[model samples]
Target: MKRKPPTISPEDSELFRDAIGDVRRIEAEPAAPARPGPPPEPRRLRIDEEEALRESRRAPADLALDAADLLSYCRPGLPERVFRQLKRGEYSIQDEIDLHHLRAADAEALLKQFLNAARRGHHPCVRIVHGKGLRSEGAPVLKSLVDRVLRHRGDVLAFASAPLNQGGSGAVLVLLDER
Candidate 1:
C-alpha cells in the first residue's frame, strides 16, 4: 500500500537549530581557505634520457668505479665525474616507492619486480618509502617484510636508509644485483 512519509515537526527543527547556535551550516559554506597568491611555476632537474639507458646497461659491478676511474674516460680536472655521471639521470635511475598502503598480499609483486630488474642486467636501485609507523596500530609491517625478503632475496645486494634529502630515515635505498 502507498503511504505518505511522516513529516518532522517544525518545533523539532527549531529546537535543533537553537541547540547548534554557534555551529555553522556546513552544507552552505566555502569549501577551502582563501588563497594568498597565485601558484608558483614548477621546476624540473635536467635529465639525459640516452645516457640513462646506457648507464642502466652497464653491469652493476662497473658502478663501483670511483671518480678517479671516470677521469680516465673523460677529460682532466673533473673532480667528481663519477657522481656527476650518475646524477646525469643516465646510469643510475632513481624511483620512489610507497609502502604506506601496501597490503601483505602484494609482496609477491615486489619480488617479481626485483627479479625482473636483476634479469635486465641493470644496476637497478629504488627508494622504498616505508613511512614511520606513527599512524599504524602495530609495528611497521612493510619495512619488516622488506627486511625479511632481503635476507633471502638473491637479487638484493644491499639496502640502507636514505639521507635527509632522500626521504630520511623513513625510506631505504635498495641496490639490486645484475640481471
Candidate 2:
C-alpha cells in the first residue's frame, strides 16, 4: 500500500526557484534554555505508605490458637454488656470480609485495611469470616491473625465469635470505635 511521493520535474523545480527570486535561511531561536521543570511533587507520604504496606505483607509471627476455639476481645474500659452484645451478634453487621483461603500475610493486610475503611465509613459493626482454618497445616493461621490484629487496633472496641446461626466459631463480630 506504499506509494512513492510525486516528485517535481527538474524544469518545474527551476521554475519554482525563479518565481521565488531569493530566500534566506531562518534559524530557530535557540530553544529557550531548557529550564528545569518544577521539582517533582513530594512523594514522602506515598513512599511511607508503600513501605508500611510492604512491612505489613511480611508474615506475622505465629500465635497458638486452635481452629475450633471461639475468639473474643474487649478493649480495656469497654463495658461487659457491650462485649456480651457483640458475642450475641446483636449489633447489625454493616460490613464483612471473608479471609477463607488467603495466606496469613495477605489476610492480615486486608483485615487491617478493611477495618480502617469500616471505621472511616462510620460502620459500628463488621464481621470477619476466617473459616476456622480447617485446611491449615498446623494452627489456624488467619483466625489467629485476625485475633492479633484486632487486639492491637485502637479502633476495635470489642470482638467475639459469632453465634451458631451466624457462622459460629468460624467468624467474629467486631464492634468498632467511632472515628
Candidate 3:
C-alpha cells in the first residue's frame, strides 16, 4: 500500500504560518524561442565579380573611355569643336555633383542618377567634381570611375576636364543629350 504524507495538526500549521512571512504570487509567463527570419540582402561585390560584370556590360569601342589618360570623350558624329568649347568652360553649367569622399561604387551610382536627372530636366551642361587622387593610395579612384561611367552613358554627348578656375583635372564638364 502507498504511504500517505503525514498531515500537520491544525495547531502546528497555525504555529508554522505565524513563523513564516506572508507570500505573494507572480502572473508572468516564460518567453518562447524566437523564430528565424529570411536571409539578408547582399551589399558588397567581390573584386572579381565586379570586374566581370563591368566587362560583360562594357561600353562599345567608340564609347569606351580610358581611366589613365585625360578625362575626355565625345560620341561619334559630334563636332570636335564642341568638345574643345566644353574643355574651355564655354557652356553654362546647369547642375553639378561632387564625389570627393565617396567610394567607387557609390560615386558610380550617384553619377548615373545625376546624369539621369540632368537629362530628364533637359539640362544641356553639368559639372562633376571628382577630386584628384592626391589623398588616394594610388590612382584617383572616383575620377576614373566617373570617366568610365560617363563614356558609357548614351545620354552623355561629351565630357572634358574643367578649366583651372572650375577645378581643372579634378573636375569634368559633362554635356548631356537634350532628350
Candidate 4:
C-alpha cells in the first residue's frame, strides 16, 4: 500500500517563501562524459629501482679474492671441449653483468637475477666483469663473490676468466644451461 504525500497549507507555503528572498531557477548544463586516464605506473619496477639505489649506497662487503687469480668452473658431466670453448670465449656472449664496485650482497643479488634472466631467455653464453681488486683494500670482493655464486648455481654449465682482450682475470665468460 502507498501513502499520499503530506499536503502543505497555502498560508504556510506563502509564509515560508516570504521569510526567504526569491531565488532564480538554476539552468543545469549537461556534463561531458568522463574519459579514462592513462594506466597506472609500474609499482614493482619502481620498487626494484629504489632497492637498487639503496644497495648502491651501502658500503662494499669485506669478501676478497686475489686480483690475478683466474676464475674457472665446469660441471662434472660437461664435455671437456665445451669447457675449453667457454675458457677460450668460443661462444658469443649474448648478455653480461658487471659487478665492478658493487657490495657483496648487491653483486650476488644482481648475479642471480641476471643468470635467471639469461636462463629463462635461453641465452647460452654471457660475461661478467667483476673487476680486478687492485683498488680494493684487501682483495677483489666482487670477483670472489661472482666465483662463489656461479659455482653454486645449477644452471651454470661452465665459466672461466674471459680472454685477455675481453677483460682477462677481471671478468669471466659464463656458459649457461639452455632452458
Question: Which one is best on lDDT?
Answer: 2
Model 3 bad stretches (over 4 Å):
1-53, 56-69
For all predicted structures, in order, the TM-scores are: 0.43, 0.66, 0.63, 0.64
- Kindly indicate the candidate among 1 and 3 with the higher lDDT: 3
Q: How many pairs of residues collide in model 4?
A: 0
**Candidate 4 residue-wise lDDT, 33-100, digit = tens:** 99999887756545654665465446355434689999988999999999998898889999988887
lDDT of 1 at 1: 94
Model 1: what TM-score? 0.43
lDDT of 3: 0.79
Ten-residue region with minimum lDDT total, candidate 2: 41-50
lDDT of each: 0.50, 0.84, 0.79, 0.82
- Residue 115 lDDT (model 4): 83
In model 1, residue pairs whose N, Cα or C atoms come closer than 3 Å (at least 3 residues apart or on different chains), thus clashing, are 51-90, 52-90, 55-91, 118-179, 119-179
Judge candidate 1 against the unseen true structure and give its global Cα lDDT, from 0 to 1: 0.50
Model 2 ranges off by over 4 Å: 1-63
lDDT by residue for model 3 (100-140), tens? 99988888778777877887798989999988877776567
